[model samples]
Target: MATIRALVPTQLERRMKTPAFGRRALLAGFGIGALGALTGCRAEGFAPSAVPNGNIGSNLNIYTWGDYSDPANLEEFGRQGVQVQTDSFASNEELIAKLGATRGTSGYDIVVPTSTYLTLMSKNGLLEKLDLGKIPNLANLDPEFQDSIADPQNAYAVCKNWGTTGFLYDSTVINRPMNSWADFLEAAQNEASNNVSLLEDPAEIAVIYLAAKGYDPLSTDPKIVAECADYLTNQLAPHVRAFSSTPQNFIIQGSMTLVHAFNGDARRGYLEAENPERWKWVFPTPTANRWMDTWAIPVGVQHPDAAYAFINFMLQPDQALKDVDYIGYSTGLTGQRELAEAAGLKMLDVLFPPAEILDRLVSLEITEASGAWVDMYGAMQAKAGA
Candidate 1:
């Protein structure tokens, strides 16, 4: 099993800026690098170990999104004889790109990635197969999440939280309503003008462009991909204020009245407002994409059983409900949605999203053939920054 270590925030901040050795330095500081040296674990050499006497947290480690797993939960798990330590990553690509370069040296027991990259990671043998027997509580997960194609048959990943990508803004300034991706594109170009922005995620930007042209966001056809990139370059290039990875920051400052964002973030930000009544979420008659966050055991995890236990612990219906409510995203837990709705969440189709929009919503897929899309977006982002 991997030994635990404390995370140093200052060191992590500097490492994050270097672009080289950033991930290795962070993993090394977190004790994962030490485990790598002790075990000589290679990318293909890892296998699951026993549950470690249910003292799960004593040596358990998780690399996940910011603030998703609270200390109270860790304390509770510790009471059950499990001790958990956590680390955070700001984006899916950051985690993926880092882990890819690390060549499986990380001692992490779990990773939370959005669906597409989870699929990509699993397909590339970067994650471990889930052992269902270790996760009885996962029975409480939504049926829709089971057998999900992102990593079918419980092979790689488990859905953690889910939300749709859309726009949110002050209702007063917009006057009417923004109800489509096209509306946002035009608003950025003519109405909201420089006040609007989009998410900086390459996949997200691709989907946004695909949706604007009424094409499947996840289409594999080269012609469709090229068309989407060209349309985005032509329509959204000039008017965007910035391709901000964190739209909430700009929204709160009022410098950005409209920006493409995830649903839960929009809600949480509005709820935090001095005047919550002034803000609103625009699902746009056609939302661009519905996304899911997932938890998966990366290949070479030494403490496999503990990883499963952690996954099961989070999947408990009550736990799932609390987490989704706290994080402001919909849970894949079967009964949690109703609980959240009863608790006064507006619970719009926007959360589940409507079938028509869901059909249009594309799942981003990774492929060797995707270089064109990646290169195009990279160029667009550079130009946008310039």
Candidate 2:
């Protein structure tokens, strides 16, 4: 695995300025840099010996979203004999780019990509087929996450965590009954104007207008894409305060009154706020995107044994519960709600929505036309001066 021992403070500072690295730095409480700088450090009296080619080694490397993994869990895994290293990426595009550039020889044993990208990555020969027999805890997953559209046979990936895209607001600032995306729009234009924020993700931002208008948020038709792009650039962009994916800091600082955010981040913001009651998290009416991130081994995995071991280890209920508490997302394990509440998870309703809300959530798929959505998003951002 690549080490960061040669990275000076100046080099680390420059990397932290990029959107991908910056988001990870912020979410991990700036520990990502510290971890990178100290990559050579190991647990007391522990030194993993290198293994020969095509053989299992006492090392596992991961590429995932920032702050998605808990340090305590990793330490426990280390105690079991394998040493682990992790790196972060901000978006799926960045993940694909780096892995593609290396032709899957990036030396990363485990990667966490959204379910929508699983099929695409597998088709490109960037991922390896999973050995289901090695992951006995696979049965612990909720049936709903099994036989997924992205990997029907659990061939390449297994769901790690799932969350929905939604908006959050400070009820104290916009004190009206808010329930739907329509209400979100009204508040953004009126009370929350010049102080509203939307996610930096183009597909996520497009969903807001597409779903509110009762259209398929994933539609890639040229006309629909153009229409959504026009409306976002002309009607909505002016009211947006900023484009960001990490809104927890702004929410706690009271810098942005309303923000389009993911469920886990929104919950973290609400819970961390001084007056938690003032923050309101909404599922939004009509529809929203429900995304799932999964664990998959890259084609050039050097430590298949360690990769399988870590996956099985994380799926256990005890370890899964710790992940839920640290990351604030559901693990899709059976009876997760009861387990979470038994462990004293605050605001159970926010993390686990009611059945009606759950029914309205939709998973996104990647198509050839997905590139057009990216182009349309670029146009919207350029026009909005964002």
Candidate 3:
């Protein structure tokens, strides 16, 4: 068992600073200048001609993950003579709630949310449709990214990066071939007893429950989701060690025998733990939901051109490569294949798992833009928490 210490950003600030490195990355990160005056890294200058033509808002307020954007990235925008500031959110739900409360008057220019949430926001008219013509770098995105379920038409948002969720288990504790989500739940039930932990968030739990019941978590039916809620509370709740919203540190200290974890976190854990084989990953059998983070221009963004410039610039092969390395996820950039190989990242199966295995994975998706489903999912989560 490992003690899991998760690095969750505070509810107030909801972000942490990544160490600024790489010459080009440093320059690109200059986009973070307006957020703070501190200079961490510098990148090539951000410049674009397609500044929004009509009724664009002046204040470039952005809401995103703390580490996703930095002082340097802000500084790059600042250099473009755009006024920008950022607010961080810990979860997609929090950002959704904020956007609703502000009612499209939040004065934010950009909002980066997970792929699933992009659908919800787009349906609600919270996101501004991207003018791809202005973002020529859209061409640089990998084919997998260009083809997304949430934004099928490439209209609402753009994929930034993607990763997966599963369990990081101690291979020696109860050695057997661990292959799927069901195996993890069974082991958590048998090995950890009441100490077994799962992700505390409703969205993930709902998805896991659906997987357990052989149903898609993104299913829109109210009755089916209710069935999922009942299934989780009845079957797995007793074995749960803890419903951890953040479980990183627990795994680190050997307090967690099995953890529902992200692939990147699992990789970091394997690297940090002295016993390399002690930590291993499990990709669900049929499929587990793939996670993606994306970028969107808010409705009132004044510096849409700079924002597009930044996105296109980020689409550059080198920029995407740096992001993949720094963020610990596979990006939708064409160059990562060679870059990851050259960087020896291919050796990390958790990062670059076997081709056949990845083919079996599925990204969670919304069946329809329905408030009823969201409410149903939310209710199921509340029950799981109880």
What is candidate 1's CA lDDT for residue 127?
77
Q: lDDT rank, highest first?
A: 2, 1, 3
- The CA lDDT at 2 in model 1 is 25
**Cα-based lDDT at residue 284, candidate 3:** 73
Any residue pairs clashing in model 2, and if so which? none
Q: lDDT tens string, model 1, 18-78?
A: 3322111211232122221111111232122234444443356788766665455555554
The alpha-carbon deviation from the true structure for residue 136 of candidate 2, after best TM-score superposition, in angstroms, is 0.5
Best by lDDT: 2
- The per-prediction CA RMSD against the true structure, in angstroms, equals 8.3, 6.6, 8.6
Runs in model 3 deviating more than 4 A are 1-60, 70-84, 220-227, 344-347, 366-386
Q: Candidate 3 overall Cα lDDT vs. reference?
A: 0.62
Name the runs in model 2 displaced over 4 angstroms: 1-17, 21-56, 383-386
Q: lDDT by residue for model 3 over 230-268, one digit each (tens)?
A: 666666666665655445555667777877767766666
TM-score of 2: 0.86
Model 2 per-residue lDDT tens digits across residues 1-386: 23222221343334344563322224533222324311223345322222233133567888888778778788777665566888877666557667877886888889988888887788777889988877888899998888898899899998899888888888889998888888887898888887888776667777887888888877878788878878888777777767776777677777888888888888888888877787888999899988888989998898887788778878888888899999888888999999998989998887887889989988888654455555555555555534
For every model shown, what is its TM-score relative to the native structure? 0.79, 0.86, 0.77
- Residue 84 of candidate 2: its Cα lDDT? 80
lDDT of candidates 1 onward, in order: 0.63, 0.75, 0.62
Error of 1 at 41 (Å): 31
